[model samples]
Target: MKKTTILDLVSRKLAPFMLLFGLYLLSYGHMSPGGGFQGGVVIASGVILLFVAQGVGTTASLFPFRTLSLVEAAAFLLLLAAGLAGLAAGAGFLGNPMAGVDVRAVPRVSMILVYNVLIGLKVGAGISFVCMYLFREGR
Candidate 1:
């Protein structure tokens, strides 16, 4: 059983581009529309494109289950640690501690950007890993 077609090729070719778009959305999230969660799903869809174009095996090779799991876990822990840092700084849990920081130097927006990137990577890797794992099970 396989999925080999012009459409699959097109998807395979477009998957990286889709991933770039998703990253763009995540990077610009603080300034414009879309954010970590949305971008993360988009990135996961890009990974899905590989599965649909090739197969579970090929996709898994590109993104090993163990590596993906590690990345996902690291991203989650980083996000949690960032929030905890904010709380420890006396800004309350998940609060925007950057607000009180030296805006003229660091700028509060940087915190949001970092958070967005962390969340995006966490969610993207987690979702993609889950999908890949399930698809592998199916095979």
Candidate 2:
């Protein structure tokens, strides 16, 4: 595929906003409709856009495969740790650890927020890695 100067420039300009939007979705997900999966897909779409506009080699250099794999692994482990912490706290697996806490002291949605962030990181890294691999294989 031939890369165009205009496509590359536009993608570079737009990618940051896509990332910011994804973060917004993850942060406010507890109060709104968007959540981990959706936000993560959005983030991955930005990277994929770069892959298409800038070529696989350039994009891969910016987002290395090793780094993406490690990030995905770490996010998954943290999610599991969160679930275990909840179980240890007697809230059941994947339940809110702060369920009994006063809402004023700490919002009841804190756990949901944490879960959203972790899941977003995991999904984003995993999808980006897979797409990067596919793009390379096509070469």
lDDT of 2 by residue, 1-139 (tens): 8777888789999998998999999888889989998999999998898888887789888998899999999999999999999999899999887886667877888899999999999999999999988888445
Tens-place lDDT digits, model 1, residues 26-54? 99999999899999999999998887667
RMSD of 1: 1.7
Q: lDDT scores for all predictions? A: 0.87, 0.90
Candidate 2, lDDT over the whole model: 0.90
Badly placed stretches (over 4 Å) of model 1 are 137-139
